[model samples]
Target: MQVITSESVFSGHPDKVCDQISDTILDAILEQDKKARVAVETAIKDDFVFIFGEVTTTAKVDYKEVAINKLKEIGYDEPFNVLEKISKQSPDIALGVDSTESHEQGAGDQGIMFGYACNETKELMPLPIMLANQISKEMDNARKEKYSHIFGPDGKCQVSVEYEKGKPKKVKTIVVSAQTKSWINRELYEDIIINEVLTKVLDDKAIREAEILINPTGEFVIGGPYADSGLTGRKIIVDTYGGYAKHGGGAFSGKDVSKVDRSGAYYARYVAKAVVRANLADRCEVQLGYVIGISNPVSIHINTFNTGVISDEAIQGLVSKIFDFRPSMIRKELLLDEVKYQDLAKYGHCGREDLNVAWESVDLKAKQLRKLYEETKRASQVL
Candidate 1:
């Protein structure tokens, strides 16, 4: 059987903590200024949190307050303790993002972004990633619920699934590492994780046979930002499709939708989801490219992996005809400029059909794509 493995981290993980912080700031700015130019980066080391990067807008919001408040909301009860540890944004980077013209919008910075979809799951997300995220989220919930003797904020989860003939067949291995207060012994820690976290996460009987690794490295007393330096964009793979597809290398956590890296990726996913929902393809991957200062996309590519009844080229043509890939157009299409990304900062970004995110809405586009596919099939049959 073919095998595919994927991993996910909890929100309290150092890298994810940074991501949440950055996006929280972005959302705050966007709330006041719909056209806010935000490119924020956060770094967490030890007990200290350092926020850097730039944002330009008319909104009169306090960055420091926002940062501290957001941290506190994310289960950090000791703000005074952590606040003294954090720093402010740098003035140099702020100069570039505080621009006026549409074309003048430089990418908050240069990087690549990727969007992907497949028939492996109803959300078109890979099963391994979906499973990994489930486990990670469950761990967080268990901690929040005060599950006895579990762990602290820092945790990571990985799932490797055995695939048969390119499809997931059964679970292979499950690994979870969670940091606990110094008092908890390893024996009790393992018992708590297995019974409370893993059991609840993989409730399906099919997953019971999988191998389990609880803190494979042994001691996790030194976790969180203290043990490891955490920075924004470090978890890009986990944020997106868990390496099931290619990543453009652009991180999504800190930038506003104007940056194609964020908005464009969301639009690409929307297009792919629509294609699959229309039954034109069982799986789809859409790629979008843009030039800084240009409103329209520089390139758009589609891959359906022979799942489409129409040629890839034909699918591309239809996509170009139906979807708008321009930065401005994408913003309008997805209403992304209005989305509150801070909440999405935690949890997996994709597969959040519950969030009512514009990218998640395929109802309108799905109908249109199905009509296009039916017309194409009719024409081909006539020939």
Candidate 2:
């Protein structure tokens, strides 16, 4: 059996702690100042949290208070001393990015960002990542609601799924390393985690026969920032397709949508999902390239992995016509400014049904593109 693995972390995980804090600050700033330019980063170790980056906003945001509150909300009640080192965005960089009467807004920075979609899951995401993320969410929910006495805030999950002919056939293994109360008996702890967390999400045969490892390293009393140091943008693979696709190395949280890293990536996923939803392909990945201070993408490309009903070239042509890739247009089309980065900070960003993100709802584009694909197919069988 061929196996592919993907992992996810609980909200209290060190890196996620930083991710949430950064986005929480970003959210607060955006709420007060829609036009603000924010690119923040967070790092944590022990009882210390460091927030540093470039932020130009009139939102009157209390960055320190916001970061501390977010930490507490993630189930960390420890006293954390925070150090803030923030500065304004450089006017030199901002000069080319801002919109003018004659010049449209350009990209925030130069980089490659990828978006992916497949029919393996209802969310059009890879099964391994979707399941891994669900287990983590369930773990956090259990700690918050039922087993507060037994579980701690920090934890992680990795799921390896067996595939047959490129399709997921079953789950092969589940590895859970979670923070737990030291007093809980080993027997009861495993039972609770097995029944309450694992079975609740993966009761099917996929999980029943699989090997499940719980608290592999024994005691988990020491967890969260106390256990390890965490920095933002470190989990880029977990944030997106879970190693099923390539990443352009851009982190989404903490930055406002003005940065093409966040906005452009969202738009790329929107296009990939649209292609799959249109039945033009069973799998899709769209890559968008931008140069800082340029409003439009320097390159737009697509790969259907030989799963497209039409040729990749035809699909790329359709994408050019149906979607707008300009920095300003991407923000406007996806309603980026209106979204709360904190909500997307935890779960995987691309394929989310829980959040009402514009990128996920590509039905309008799907319908139009499906019709266009039919005409294009008739016009050129060569495609």
Candidate 3:
């Protein structure tokens, strides 16, 4: 059997903590100035959290308060220091993107963005990552509610699924490493993690005979930033498809909607999901590339992985007709500036159905493209 592994961590994880902090600041800025240009980076080690990045906004904010509040919400109560080095964006880089008399707003930066979808799960997400995310969410809930004093804030979940002929057939194993303030017996901890966390999230049939490993390294009493360092944009894989799909090597956190790394990726997902929802393909992956000072994408590619009813080129042609990859157009269509990104900091961003995110909307543009193709084929056959 071919085994694929995917992992996810709670919001309290070191990298996730940094992600939340950065996005918290971003959301606060966006709440006041929707057109703010923000690209914040955060790093936490021990009791000190360092914040540094570029910002050009009309919004006034207390950066320290935002960071501390995020920490407290994540269940970290220890005294901490916060340092700030935020400043306005560079005019050289902004010149091309700023509105001008000759050109529309150009891309914020040059980079590629990727989007993916598959029939493996209801959310069109890969199964292993979905299972990993579900387990992580459940673990976070336990820490927040009934077991606040018992379970620690930082934790990780990894799931291995066996695939047969490109389909997930069974769960091979599950690994959970949760932090706590006290030591609990192995048997008891494993039981709680299994019954309370894993079993509740994983598919019953897939995990029927799966092996579970909990805190395999004996104890995890020390975790969070106290145990390790965390930096923003460090969990890109977990933020997207958990390694199941190709990435354009861009991170989503700590940036405003103007950055194509964040907004373009969202638009790609919007287009790919429309393709899958239209039944043109059982799976789809869309890639987009852009250059600063340009309004349109420099490159566009689509791969259905041989699962499309038509050729990849055909799908690409249809996608180009249905979706606009220009930077300004993406921001406008996806309503990126209006979104609050803090909630997207924890869970994987692509397949989120819990939030009314615009990118998750299932549009029928691809379906219309398919209908047009069918009609053309019928007309040609009549000739």
Tens-digit per-residue lDDT, 1-383, candidate 3: 69999999998999999999999999999999888899999999999999999999999999999999999999999899999999899999888887778878888999999999888887788999989998999999877887776788999989998999999988899999999768566677677777777768865665668987888898999999889999999999999999988899889898997789999999888888888877888989999999997889989999999999889898787777777888888888887877789999997898898888889876566567677668756876999
* Cα lDDT of model 1 by residue, 163-201, tens digit: 887788888998888887878878877777778777776
Which lDDT tens digits does candidate 2 get at residues 1-383? 58999999999999999999999999999899999999999999999999999999898988889988898888888788999999999998889998999888888899989999999988899998999999999999998999889889999999999999889988989999889888889888788888878888887576688999988877778898888999999888889989988899999989998898888899999999999999999999999999999888889999999999878998999999999999888888898878888999896897887898999999999999998987776777776
Q: Which 10 residues in a row give candidate 3 its minimum summed lDDT?
A: 183-192
Best by lDDT: 2
Clashes of 3: 0
Candidate structures ordered by lDDT, highest first:
2, 3, 1
Residue-level error in angstroms, candidate 1, position 236: 0.4
* Alpha carbon lDDT at 357, candidate 1: 89
State the displacement of the C-alpha of residue 371, model 1, in Å, after optimal TM-score superposition. Answer: 0.7
Question: Where does model 2 exceed 4 Å of error?
Answer: 380-383
* Cα TM-score of candidate 1: 0.90
Candidate models: Cα lDDT each: 0.77, 0.90, 0.88
TM-score, every prediction: 0.90, 0.98, 0.97
CA lDDT of 347 in candidate 2? 69
All predictions: root-mean-square deviation over Cα?
3.4, 1.4, 1.4
User: How big is the positional error of residue 112 in model 3, measured in Å on the Cα after superposition?
Assistant: 1.0
lDDT of 1 at 263: 83
